[model samples]
Target: MKPRIIMNFALIITLYSALTFYIGWNGWIWLHTAFGLQDKWIFGVILELISFSYIIGHFLKGIPFFKVIGAYWFGLLQYAILFLPLANLIALVLIYLNLPTTTIVKWVGAFVLAAFIVLFLYGSFNAYSPVVRKYSLAIPKNAGKLTKLRIAMASDMHFGRLSGISHARRLVREVNALKPDLILMPGDIIDDDPEPFIQKNFGDVMKDLSAPLGVFGVLGNHEYYGGGIPRYLTEMNRIGITILLDQVTNIADSFYLVGRKDKTDRDRMPIEDLLMNTEINLPIIMMDHQPAELKQAEKNHVDLLLSGHTHRGQMAPNHLITKRMFEVDWGYLKKNQLHTIVSSGFGFWGPPLRIGSRSEIIQIDVTFV
Candidate 1:
């Protein structure tokens, strides 16, 4: 790595360590004072393990328990970092007011625990209960004999350990029930690893996803991160879902379905280059993982653009950041002739919790006039 890259990585490590220490220190204080927990060494060891479990999980991929702890920790870590300081401040105020330290600690701990429990329950519900987001539009172009097209698009399924067979079954059942003519998965079909997906036999559940126009997906950044493109492709292909990699296909000579490699791909073909040989008259529906370069799609005359990858922050206040980052983080955006619909995602990453955004599948009804 270059010197700057090394410096940045070191900085990140230092910050993460400092934050972990702060959280650990606060947690220790709470436990010791509130519950009279005397075992500091045991507590310290457990805290260290839990705090860095995800990083350790990366090294020890065979042990999924660490990964699970790490994932949940990551989710808790954010909220803990956000609220712990406030909790500490509240404790400080109680002290200033001459309230009993033990009483204050106990109450504060109880409140925080209750808050987390509620958040977990609510967030889990949002993560699991997917709703169909419907969109209807018309294009002044013809798609051969096809009058209307019902497209079922889902992105960031992140099928893995957390989002296991049950989630896959739900997705299959839901999408199949929609009876869409075509199914498009914009990206993140797997969650950073194809091992869990393949090992757990998720494809069996996913294979039940039915669409007459066939199921198509593209690589998300996670898929790229997993470095299992060949394995993922083979499995998807076997299950009858085509994983498009910077390729375009003519759908029954009616319209074009263009799939681009994730934006992470440095060599990903430009929109203009991808559409170079395509007929200008036919309606073109494109899928790119991240919702970047909206103008390019519009400029290239893409009739519709489908994407996911944003997860719309997946959690609250985070969506605020995502909104500023992307032109259309989640939902519809129309620029000239291009219609873009970005799904919050069917499956989630990390915590399987969604506070701001609900897990969703996009049902787009397009009529070619």
Candidate 2:
């Protein structure tokens, strides 16, 4: 077999084994220990089947039914992550209280399942219905010709089987209602799948979206992962979005908007080179997919930087990981007169759920000082 195939198979097996082990731990406590079922094989088989379904769904994502099943599996994984530690803690407490093993298992099992349900429901609602997060910046008076500019920005929409055309339409409507002067999308607008948009012609819905300064965007890593950057760019342009790939433009002569290609692109232009020979007096707004190389942005004197690759960890427990990885994983940060806004995301990537972070479209109101 080819080396690539061998590597892929190894990766899949490793992931499947890991998930099975995690789910099996929960199963042991809830099934045999709690309900007095002695058939370990049955529980083991159930976990194996669940993991198999999840693994298969990735290969068959083009099929809508499989995608739905895959979404459920992903959601199960997240819920398990949320409850496993709590269940373990409950088990310890019960043992300390001198409760019978069966009683302890039963109560802890029930508690864990109930908590999972509540959390899942709350997370689902939070993910599907995004709120508008607002921020204001006082710009230096000499920075621009405009006095006040309202900009609505969102990133990491990740529209696919889970977050489909309806989600896109809702985002457009909500953003339009805000009546921002300019609409900005940092990156990851598509979730590595161009088929859904192609089949549904979701771009038509996007045509309804309007902004006087025009809707401009930069590429996110997903755009490349989803396949056919040229095709995706064509579609985006058709829907009235001007994608800026290492390009700069003056929005109605008010300020400069520089759209940088995603960091994931190895051949992407350097920030310093992009700024060279450019007017520095105007307020410079940059749309970079990932919030890395902060010093570069500061060194370039970028007035504002917007991004959304982190998704603020997308779910609980993992949100903590993202927080630690990025200087400003979510929300707004101002340093050395340069402002950065990293959105959690306009939509989610998997499970159709959000635990620790919020799904938001940020509205940044800038008033020249």
Candidate 3:
């Protein structure tokens, strides 16, 4: 790249980063106001977010020795951003309602929030990587009969500098350990741009995956956002994972996996056609990037549906709002015999911060009794 061009790109990046931070702080202020809203509890949280925000500015710049301090500061920042002004409003309302916090209670609340700030940051960023959990579900006798099945699920790999080969290796190491019948990556393996990351890391890590039933993936909203669907789809294909674009594939003889294009995609698959022959009754698992279209999964009588897009709000109180943002926030939910599991995701995305929720990869075991 030319020197002038390189300088220009850096300038653009700086501007974009500034915009992101501003939006994050602003959104969080309102988010905290909307939630985290207890008396005194909210008051302590607001102060911390400010300190941490400053820390983040330092860390991103490679300000040596400031990293750990930044970590703590960033955590407190999260708390404050989500706690203070919101608590003030709640307190005012309480006062009007003839309820006021006692002095001792206020002191205790402050102490607790201070502690919470420390813990949240440790868990969110400084903490060691989490072990992925494997789950087993027995075939319900009421269903009349069953067949053996297992699926591995992971999402939100992000695939940027923060989540490169080493991270992918750690994750694939876990995936191999599960010995799942099939591996499924629902979406967001690459945060926004899949090209650079795919060229950098995915080819090496994904090529070595151990699952015999094969690996399949679908487009996430970011896949659409970074470039058009074609380039991302082509890139994921080059890495060897099949892109299931609003289509069904019979992984094994007894079950079918239907993968839908992201709903936000202009060219999302017509779901009804994918569900052709509902009478077949073979166990069916559907994979779509976002959990937004859950009704279709239920209406199709899909035995199981898997998705990840919410990132479980990634930070505190954000998940609370995330629930309001989408019908499914995270984890397992059952509706009439159909099961949907949304993975909080395997890696962090933009902020590299996860306040309220932990990242996760899901291993599921299915069996016939």
Backbone clash numbers for all candidates listed: 0, 0, 11
lDDT score, residue 269, model 1?
A: 97
Kindly list the per-residue Cα lDDT of model 3 for residues 49-128, writing each as its tens digit.
44354445444543423434544454445565456556556656666777644533354345546666576656655212
What are the root-mean-square deviations of the candidates from the true structure over C-alphas? 1.0, 3.0, 10.2
The ten-residue window of minimal lDDT in model 3 covers 138-147
Off by over 4 Å in 2: 1-19, 28-46, 52-54, 85-89, 92-103, 141-145
Instruction: Report every candidate's CA lDDT.
Output: 0.92, 0.84, 0.69
After superposing candidate 3 on the true structure, give the runs of residues whose Cα lies further than 4 Å from its correct spot: 1-80, 83-121, 124-128, 139-146, 277-279
lDDT of 2 by residue, 251-297 (tens): 76777899999988998999999888667788889999999867799
- Which candidate, 2 or 3, has the higher lDDT? 2
lDDT of 3 at 70: 46
Model 1 agreement with the true structure over 216-323: per-residue lDDT tens digits: 999999998999889999999999999889999999999999999999999999999999999879999999999998999999899999999899999897999999
TM-score winner between 1 and 3, please give it: 1
Best by TM-score: 1
State the lDDT at 210 in candidate 2: 92
